[model samples]
Target chain A: MTIKLDRPDERGRFGEFGGRFAPETLMPALEELETAFAEAWSDPEFRTEFSEILTTYIGRPTPLHPARSLSEHLGVEVLLKREDLAHTGAHKINNAIGQGLLARRMGKPRVIAETGAGQHGVATATAAAYFGLDCTVYMGEVDIERQALNVLRMEILGAEVVAVRTGAGTLKDAVSEAMRDWVRTVEDTHYVIGSVVGPHPFPWMVREFQRVIGEEVLGQMGDDLPDVVVACVGGGSNAMGIFHPLAERGIELVGIEAAGEGIDTGRHGASIGAGTPGVLHGSATYLLQDEQGRVREAHSISAGLDYPGVGPEHAYFHQTGLARYESVTDDEALEGVELLARTEGIIPALESAHAIAWVARERRRLEGRRVLVNLSGRGDKDVEEIGKRR
Target chain B: MGRERLSSLFARTRAEGRAVLLPYMTAGLPDPGTSLALFEAMAGAGADGFEVGIPYTDPLMDGPVIQQGSERAIEAGTSPDVALELVAAVVESTGLPVLVMTYANPILHRGVDEFVAVAAEAGADGVIVPDLPVEESGPLRRAADRHGLGVVQFVAPTSGTARIEAVAAADPCFVYAVAEMGVTGERAEAGGRLDGLVGRIRAVTDVPVVAGVGISTPSQAAAAARVADGVIVGSALVRRVLEADSPDAATSELAQAVADLAAAVR
Candidate 1:
């Protein structure tokens, strides 16, 4: 059976998962963005410029480091995809820079984004400053409190950080607020959605931007694919980025979700493993919603992983069994963070620590196998929160 | 019991050389009981129809006022069932056209067919789903058509000619002309390309055009009604209910507001 990896058909439906479910007011904007993205993505000059920016500014071709000590401890040959080394300390800058260039091409002077842990916000702020575009980022108030370092980074980068106080004061609320802002100012502004989520062109476009990770990995691995490729899933951008290119290569694609307390305890952010199919943030996808279809608040120690919905393409991957998804609780993720720090001298972001936790949890099965994990971001911003946990 | 549908309400108002006044109220806001009373007050005060907003957890198209009302309704445990029941009660009491206004998720949650069927059973004349654009509205539109419920589509200033024609081709009972480029909120005055959008819709289809979003004052409503077949005042009236100290105060204030709007539009 040939798997069609080229997704988001003309209507943006990835099978039954993705679609452009947004307001009428923003429909034209979305259409314009779709065209702009398509033309920019196809043009050789645009691609060359985007590649040059990634190489020079954002630091592309992030190294794949073999975690020898950690691998020995887990009884697996674990290699970490070093997105943490990228400028702004995460893989988020890749997409941010891509969208920033696209916004420039579209003649949009302002770029707006919604962020969870503030990595995406910081990355977007960095890109906006680099491109001389006005930038605004909406972050949930709760996240603003926890990720203060990142908030400062965004502010210092000359981006306005708006605290979204609605709906659990988290990533979901920030997404809602950003959409509201875009609806009003869409004429001159481009919404730089951080993850591979949201309406039609967004999920597809962001995935393409982030696809650099997987494409780089294919060449780096040198004819031997890792038995498993793992990344954390919070709106699932980094995971999708690393997974889309290597999906058909017979490697196991695994996504780790943040289980705040526990999935059974109903406080986790494991949208795919625990949620039902519903629409939120403009796409038909699995959502953490109540019986009445009201979206529920997702909880995670890592603010980046605290989202009620996953990317629509991730939902499609789950439905088609293209990838397997597992979850790690907050406590387990903290333990993963400590383990990586002690063994490999690397402090992974609490979000990426979920993938580390999954590797540790399934160490027995992964024994003697080469596993690749996306170290999506650094843990510097999370050091304070980690201290509180200790 | 005879109840008004969107068609008759618009026909009667158009025959009288005036536009209908439809005031939007968030169902189960404050509480279901108080919300029903507010609907009654608006109907008695001369609301030609009603837009009963079902409070979802996330109201993306709503401004601060309606967003707060929706959050309050959700906090009060207003489930889809509870909201639809309120719609039924409002229909029974008011005997006026009542359209269910919600985002796409709630209906998708119940399964479009089941939601449309239950809404029709609950006496909802139509539905206004802001997020379900014409492209993604096929299932909801088909389901509503099967249940004899009108699907209200929106036309915005940002929409190009092809998009407006597509919305008109959906054969909506009415075209909700977004008077401004923003979400539902009370502006100091109605602004944006309202005339352009309404005129474009008129050229494309005979679906009654009702201007909504940012119409706060009666003068604004009257100004919009001059071009649109109706005027939908949402945040202005919902803000009153949200800010009122007492239910009676909300009801009386809503009554006066609706009366003033009706006097202007009609």
Candidate 2:
């Protein structure tokens, strides 16, 4: 059966917010993604090969661990989808592997991608090494300074990292710089968008690739659909992936956005919850922009969640009420970070911590019910930031 | 005169065997107030029309020099409203036909109807959104007409016959025939294919055609004048303005560049 979860323009957004608003140079890439994904998603051979790689190479079918201590603390049965155990230590690798394979199949000689918190960059570089393709990653100058270890990891994996220094000097700028590179070398290059953001098929395609998280979680749960599935929404990739399959399962999918201080404080990355529809880096989505359309800076303690715009699908889902979005402040997310590390021995990425914080705070309402939280990535990359906060 | 009136002026110029001199500049670059002085200088230098570039974060079609000017404008806090105010100041001072040249995002951000109304209020005669092609210009065109603003359209050398026809049909002013496939900036040499492109666009429309993109020197302007009715100088003027010892000096140097090109085009 065809899945309506990944349909483009549903609620006219991804999740509730994603649409194509990209430069003309990337249109062909988006079109290719639409065609290839449509074909591969239907082909049993493609599915089998993809599943084989995920299971063997990426260590898929990660366990659904019942965090008894955390459940008791929160007064709800909180189950963690152990994505932290996945190859590369994050859910980012799933989409990266899929896009990397798609790039090779499309006969691209090089792969270019943008990364914000460096997780996606590391994941993409790993895929490039695995696929034996020349890879380059564009990262913001600030991100390189903050996430030096991941930058080194990307370089060690044989991917060249270019520092982008324009337009707030962050992920958006990296995306812009990547587009410039793609325009010059579109014939031989494939741009593997790191998240479920950007225009058109990317939001849909990346989510489909990530849906394995939800599929596996549901299978492992076995007749016990959770009351709510919580995932961090940094560009909404992990959230979309974990939520897409559960939409029809009669479970509430809550996407937690980063509220740097508080959403009301006007210093947050809660684009879907607070921003307006504006075009940035090519795709029109919910973005934080001034009255004149200049993109505003977004802030979050989690570098990964500090994006001003959200994926189109998230925008759609939010608009149509397919999913619910809530904001978690830096303090709350950090509290969640500390709680998870202490209780479950799994230090979650701050982006993921936002979702954990939401689950911890709201689990009282979900008493006597099961909750699945997508543990998006390990906290190794966020150690320095966490230490600084401490 | 309004943009439609300005288009008629160019049409009359074409009929009378006179070539238009379209000078381009980034609005509020260096400073918002100084842009007015530069406009006055260009008008004194005998520019027949002006293309005011609205500063944008990513100028995909701009060469290094024009790109720097756009960056400077943005640094100086030039927004769409600032650009419109500058254009109004120029039109109020010079009475020259002014076209707002910008990417589509700023226009979209400004709200199409409000943007057109603001440009018209600022005394802009027309607008040329380079990124918005003929196919996607319906809303902008309708808005421009509603506000009595002319919609200036571009025809690239690489465009096919169908594109040329589409551009001609939507264009309300002289067709801007890009001299090359790349962005606006300084080139070591003017393009080699202008004559063919101008001839091709001329075949598609009765409107006057002006060549832009790489026409930097007087000789390039003269070469462009061989087939087109006007030559637009953007990067050359912007470079002079950016390198001037001061904004005043930049205006003088830009005036000289405009005069040299105007003489060649004439």
Candidate 3:
């Protein structure tokens, strides 16, 4: 009944990384988030209401299946933390639901979020509709074309979709444009960041909101923790959500990046694994930049993972040797998509498929040992891209 | 050798009571060939120096006009390597004191030492990175010094005395005084507070302090030059280029603007 975290440093980040790095315009809205989250998370009545909705309305405690066929093919035990079964069809809804509730509690009349593949947009829109809040989603023009179905799904949920045409006309630009809008309408709006990227407080805040995934997975796995935990890193929200709790549990955590090509080929979204420290948007994090510190164009088949920069916490994690970073090429991830579709009838998001593929290829090293893979999202949005590739 | 030459050049201009005209244009804007022609035209028009803006996608401190110019350059597929080549062309055509102005991101993306090496190789006299504050200028200053390139620094009106002292200490060339709070853009009139700001900066360092940002008209340049050592005209000149019927006309108009401003100050 009682929400555990509270206040400015809710997620407990050391200086330099975890404060809310919002502009002057968005300060009121961010302050509103602080007040709303504090109240909603602690109020037993609100907690019970959301808990019942998550369990009955959204299907909580999704089954943890031992991927037997996948294990057999890979010569090891592979377990999937079934986040794909969550309502809105991805783990993104978990955080979205929490944020939407907080938005309602704060008396905010409108909710806004930026999306790349539109999964987070759809998830946020779903929660907004459930809470009866006016929702607006900013999506990149390119992403709108790639994830047309999800865009329609958002529109069906009654959320206005605004296409951003600045910078690269992708996720980074979309977030920038949305933040600009939120700045102007801060008093009545809440900007729900989809991942653990953004300035201060966001990386830590989103992680805490989604840490429910790690808490449940640890409990569901019982007495024996897996030898390895693998999760795809797109802004690293899902990976960080599940990895943070298990980090001290002595289990190895691997965050797989969407490498459009191999790392050596210089065309990929492996920010932590392949990028250098540089400032982009607002935060100083690992980003793909040229010698003059200009942001370079990032390429990845998975729209969700194609970002030039990674979250600052991920950069911190990589720098402190707290987590291992890996890369999965588009071809390898596509194989993961096909593997899951054929074996378990589960179509994972191309972003999540990166982790799935890593598990398939790396499971050999952990033969006969347990491995928990964070099924970050489902593949509904990626069907078009996959179909074209095939 | 280059700093000495540039300093002596500034001294001669000051002694002759002639205002120094620093014409700025983005590399490969319009096109590389036209950029070269503009540089030649400005030099032939008795321009004192060149502040070459390296085209970047997100120029945090640039105005909309310069932002558009950068976008056009990027859309034309201008790369840093190509920009360096353009700088080389400008230097070859006009043996003038050239300052490369850009944001820190591109240089960091490229590797600091490599950028300095390339810029120096391109015959650039100095470099100005607007976003790199005095606190973070050591590495870049060292690199520039090693390559014999002057590291020009900016002193804003908002900077405290400590920061002014720090900037004066860090910068090798004349300190650039940003005339206003915002990015490079034309203003109807030069702000009234610049004279005091220039005097305040002068109290800290003996280096020549050049006033930039919003000094558009010949009269505005004359006013700025009365208080400061030099005047920088960026967005106004870029607008002249953009509004001109052709690139040739743009260069001629830009040259005229520079000559008119210099004569007014003189």
Candidate 4:
């Protein structure tokens, strides 16, 4: 089955999903930003400037290394897209820099962001410092406790960190707080949404920024494309980044979700497999919720993967049969970290481990074929948690 | 208690040279039983309208005060069924028109027709979905219309004239003018942008326009009522219920607060 792929419609819909579901107060701002992004994207100078910064500042074109040992072990030539090598130790910096530039260009002197695992917070802070834009990061109190090092990194880089204590005090709540801040301060502030979720233009604009991941891969490959590409899905930004350029490629694209305990145990972050489509955090997408429609708290060892919803584009892909989804348990993800560390001498973030585990499980089918995995982030932030597990 | 009945209340207020006084509260805040009693008391205290909230696990548009109230209510087991029951009881007790203020997921999950039928059966006059934009509200609006229920649409201070026209086409009992740029919260002064929004809304729709979201004080209510046909106060009086020492005290205090705002709207 072929999936018909194109840009979002004028209303910013990916098929029947994704629209501006925010309060009316935010509608005018969204329209304004949408227009600005279109104009910027069309400008040749903007593209050249963005590319120059990615190359010089963010350390882009991260190597696509062939994992020889892991390949020999699995009987497949497994390739790794080393996004972990990016300046902020994650792929988040790529999108943050683009948005930070846009914010500055729009003359919004201040920027705000929400982070779950703190990778986005650090990335935004780094970009804000680069552009000399005033920055504030809203983090869940629970996340601040888990990812304390990142919080310190953001603060030392000149961004104010606020601990959000409302609701479940997780990524969802943090995004809510950031949006509330944006509503009042929008006159001079730009909300740097860290994911391909929330209202329109956001999901669309974030994809536009992150598509560089796939574009770079295709450009570097020249002729031969991988038989399969894999990335873990939280809000699915990185996955969409890689998959979108390859969506019409007709190759296999696997997005691994976190099955915290197990899918059947109802303690997982697999929104596409086990959730219904509805609105949350201002965008209509697949969400984990109860029969009464109260969104349930998602669980994962990786703070970044513990979210109740996936990006609407992922939902669109799922509906169109363009991309297939699989899930890996926390135990399997931990084992994935160990195997990659031992074999490739490369440490993976707990969130990225899920993708690594999926490749391991599906290795037999991919034997002697080329595959790519989005190594989204480094393991430095999760070493303490992994140590505790051991 | 339906749209026609709700319309008459607004008509009476307009003819009296005043705006309707709408008081909002979470269903099971400070507990369910007392919340119902407080609604009855507010009606007696001269409230012209009500917006009853259904507690959800996630309230993206709510500020800390209402979030706390919703969390408490959810802990007290105010599910969709329970919330509908409370609506029914409020209708029976106060005989005042009520609108259920909620996010979109609950209605979508319950099957729009089923939820609308239940709410209509429970005597709800209208529904206000903060996250359901006018463009995507067709299915729910159709179901609500079938049940003779009005679906209220909100006009934001930042809304352009085109959006104002679109919201006006939703055919609400009244256009709820969001008095500020942010989520539901208490503010000392009504937003400076609110009057401009109300005037723009008046140009689009013939229905009454009600100012809401940040009008916390009696003076703020008075200020907002000058440019609109009514005012709706949430976070303010709900905070009073949270602070009162007892449920009886909450009822009396809330009633007093509603009365003060009601008198000010005139």
Candidate 5:
């Protein structure tokens, strides 16, 4: 198999996993966006400007650092892709800047996004501020409490943060609220979706934007391919970015899902490993749903990983055997956070620590081999919440 | 039982020189008993047709009012079975054309063909799935047609000519014309594109067209009904019923409000 996944095939479907499951009112807007993005991608001027901005402003080609201490401890050559070094302190800025530019190109003066852990919110706010566009981010009320510093950072960056108080008051509800906002304000506003979820174009488009990570890794790694590549899967954007370009190039692609308390307890966010395919938030992906097909609330210590649905592409990858998915418990991920801080002097976001936790699980098997891990965001925003976990 | 009843209702309303008044109520909301009473009260009040919503856990396209009603229904254990029973009871009591307006996931979970058969057997006249667009509606539409259940399709103000054609091709009993680019809610007035969209839809099909979303006040409904065949009042009626102190009070107040709403459209 060439790993040729011709998905979203004019109907936004990845082998029936993804489609535009939105309301009638949003259909035209989504169509308009699809057309605009295609045109932007083809236009030389547009590509040049977007690339220049990504390189100079958002800080591209985030370094691939050799984690010597982690390597010695794990007995494998563990290298960390420092997305934490990006300007907004996470890899989310890559897509945010791309969308901000796309918003401008489409003559949309306002942009709105939904955030879980607030990294995407801050990145969006920062990009919107730089580009002189009005920005608003919808965050769940619970997340607003859990990630207070990020909310403050968004405010300071001049983006309006609306607290969504629906459902479980988490990422899922925040995205729903943002969709509601867009339905009411679609004429001049662009819905800058945070992750690779939602309707058509988002999963495909977000992957295209984040593909820079994998492309850079291929160049940095020189002639040899790593034996393993690992990244945490929340909505799976960061993982998709690193995994897509290197898809056909044979390397073990592993995605770590958050197993909040445990999968058996039905409290985890491991949608793929333990979920059925269903439509939610504009996409038909793997979802935690009841027999009545109502979306079940997901829980995780890390707000970013606490969602009931995964991206559609990740579902395809799982089915095609292109990637293997595993779950890490909240306790295990926290331990990974502690281990990385102590050994490598790097504090990773709890979302990223899920990948670090994978290393601990496969230390013996991965010995004498090289592995690449996407360290998605810094753990600075998580310190306060981590402190309270005790 | 489905489209024929709806056809007769509209024909009668048309002969009377008044637009049909389709009122939406969230099923099993505020407890099943009250929800049942509210439907009967609405039928007696002057509703030409009824659109009953099966409350889902996530009603992404709903406004605050309907969302509140849906959450209440969900909390009160209004699953698909419960909602179907509610639909049956409403139809048995009212003897009026009643349509089930719900999201697609529930039906998809139950098996589309099975769901349509069950809904028809339960006395639902028709169904309106907001998220299932015409392109992805082949299976459900075929099942609905086989069961004589009208599968209502929608055309939004933002829809292009091709989509308008596709929706027309779906040949719904009535084209659900979205009056605005937003979720179901009470607004000061409807969007300004009702005439344009209704006119475009009329050019394609002879199906009856009903405008919904943001048409709240009696005057707003009348204004919108001028260009369209009928109007569906959602958040406003749902809001009024929610505000009444008692179910009996709710019955009278809601019935009176629906009558007033009927008169304005007339």
Candidate 6:
């Protein structure tokens, strides 16, 4: 199936899946951001500055490591896009630095962000420090405790880490609180949304900022596009980043969602797989909600994948049959971490482990076919949680 | 009831030379029965209208007071259906203009047309979806117009002149001029943008402008009333009900607060 990367039409809609459903107070800010990003994205100077930062600061052009041992074990050519080697240890830095630069161009003096696993927070904090922009990262109290090291990294980078105690005290709540702050501070603050979520300009802007991942893969692979491209879907930045360029290439794009236990157990973050289309966090998308449309809290051992909502573009892809979505339970993701560590000496983040687990599970079916997986982040942050589980 | 109900409320309040007092309360809070009584009490205490919030799981525009109230209301079994029933109850008992305030998901989830139809059938004067701006509100506005239910529009301090004009063109029953930039909560001061925002909206349309958000005290409500056509006091009143010792105390305190606000605005 072919997926068109050109979406979120003028209204920022991916089919019927995305639109600006934000509060009126934020409407103008979103419009301003959309305009600024458009101008900046097109300007050669802005492009040069952003690319320069990615290469010089973020250590971009991260290698496409061919995991020969893992490929042999799984009976498929496993190519890993090592975003795990990027600055701040995740693909989140690409969007953060790009948005941080855009924020500076927009003349916004401060930036606010929301994080679940704290990767985005750390990345944003790093960008803020580099850009000399005041930064605040809203994280759920639960996530703050679990991802304690990232919290310290953010603080050390001079970003204030505010713990959100509302709702389930997780990523969903952090996004809500960051939005609340942005509502009031829109005059001087830019909300650097970590993923391809939220209202207009955000889903589109973030996807464009993160498209470097796919673009790099295009150059690195040199005409031999993998038969299937896989990445974990938690708000779906890394997945969208990698799958976007290869979407129309006729390669199978698979998104792995975190099914905390199992989909049938009513505890999972498999939004597109086991959710209904609904509005949450400022856009219409597939979200885990009850019959009453009250968003249900999603569970994932990976905090970054614990959100109930998926990106609107992913929802559109699922609807158009452009890509396939599957789920992996927490235990399966854990085993994936162990497998990758033992076979390739690479400890993958629990978020990326979900994607690896899917590849491992479908190894027999995927035998002899080349597969590309986005190792979205490093597992250093997950070592504590993994230690406890082991 | 339709936009005419809200228009006439503002007209009557204008004639009296007093700003329309609309007290906001979360439905099913402190129990469904007590909330109904509080609305009735506010109506008796000279409130011109009421904005009854349908308890939602994620009320991003709301701060802790209303958020906690919503959580409690939802915990006590206030589904959208039950909340609409409460709207009907408030209408039946108050005999005043009642607007249903909620986020967009609930309305969209139930189908915009169906939700507006049910709200109108339940005697709602208007609907305030804070998150649904004019750009994304086409379907909702069309459905609301079909059901003769007014879709309330919002103009924040951050709204540009063009945005205010667009909101004015939507023909809202009334324009909610956010008194401040932040979420719904009590504040030390109501910020200095109320007058300018009201002026901007008045320059474009004759829609009655109601200032809300952070207008907690009677003095702040009076300050906002002096600038806009109406004043919306939510978090402060919701907090009264939340902090009250008993149902009786909550009702009495809420009634007293409403009376003070009404007198100040008058």
Per residue, candidate 6 scores C-alpha lDDT tens digits across A1-390 of: 344468578888888888999999999889999999999999999999999999999899999999999998888889999999999899999999999999999999999999999999999999999999999999999999889999999999999999999999999999999999999899999999999999999999999999999999999988888999999999999999998888867899999999999999999999998998889999999999888888899999999999999999999888887888999999999999999999999999999999999999999999978999999999999999999999
Candidate 1 C-alpha lDDT tens digits along B91-153? 888788889989899888888999998999999999999999999999999998888889989
Q: What are the TM-scores, per candidate, against the unseen true structure?
A: 0.99, 0.87, 0.70, 0.98, 0.98, 0.99
Runs of candidate 2 with Cα error greater than 4 angstroms are: A1-6, A9-33, A40-45, B1-6, B9-23, B56-77, B103-106, B130-137, B150-240, B259-266
lDDT of 2 by residue, A1-390 (tens): 233454665312443244454433344455566888788788888788889999999999988889989987788889899898899889999999998888887888899999988999999999999999999999988888878889999999999999977666688778767776775566688888988876567777888899898888778877878888999897988888888888866898899998899988889999988888766655567788777776778888887898898877777677777898999999999999999999988899888899899987876688887788999988898899888989
**Ten-residue segment with the worst summed lDDT in candidate 5 chain B?**
B238-247
Which scores greater on TM-score, model 2 or model 3? 2
Candidate 4 residue lDDT tens string, A220-314: 88779998999999999999999999876868898999999999999999999899998888788999999899999888888898899999999
Sorted into a CAPRI-style docking class, model 4 comes out as: medium
lDDT of 5 by residue, B1-266 (tens): 98788888778877877788999888875577788888887778778878999998888889889988888778888888989999898889988889998888888888899999999999888899998888677888999989999888889988888998999888788899999888989876576889999999888888889999999888888987888889999898878767778777877778888988888888
- Predict model 5's lDDT versus the native: 0.89
Candidate 3 per-residue lDDT, tens place, A1-390, comes to 221222324422332334333332233344455566666677899778777877887798877889888888787788899888989888888788888887887788899999988989999999999999999999989889889999999999999999977676788777766675664456678778898876545666677778878888878877788988999887888898888888756788899987888888989988888888776654557888766556777778888898888777777677666788999999999999999899888999999999989887776677877788999889988899899999
Better of 4 and 5 by lDDT: 5
Report clashes for each candidate as comma-separated counts: 0, 34, 24, 0, 1, 0
Compared with the true structure, what per-residue lDDT tens digits does model 4 show for residues B112-216? Answer: 999899999999999988878787788889999899998888888778899889888878878889888788899766568887887788787889898888889
All DockQ scores: 0.91, 0.27, 0.13, 0.76, 0.77, 0.86
- Stretches off by above 4 angstroms in model 4 are none
Clashing pairs in 6: none
**Can you write out model 1's per-residue Cα lDDT over A100-120, one digit (the tens) per residue?**
999999999999999999999
Clashes of 3: 24
- Which numbered prediction scores highest in DockQ against the true structure? 1
The 10-residue segment of model 3 chain B with minimum total lDDT is: B129-138
Candidate 5 lDDT by residue in tens digits, A1-390: 345554468988887778888888888899899999888878899889978988898678889999999889888899999998999889999999989999999999999999999999999999899899999999999999999999999999999999999888999999999999999899999999989999998998888888889889999987787889999999999999999988877899999999999999999999998988888888888989998888899999999999999999999899889998999999999999999999989999999999999998889999888899999999999999888875
TM-score of 6: 0.99
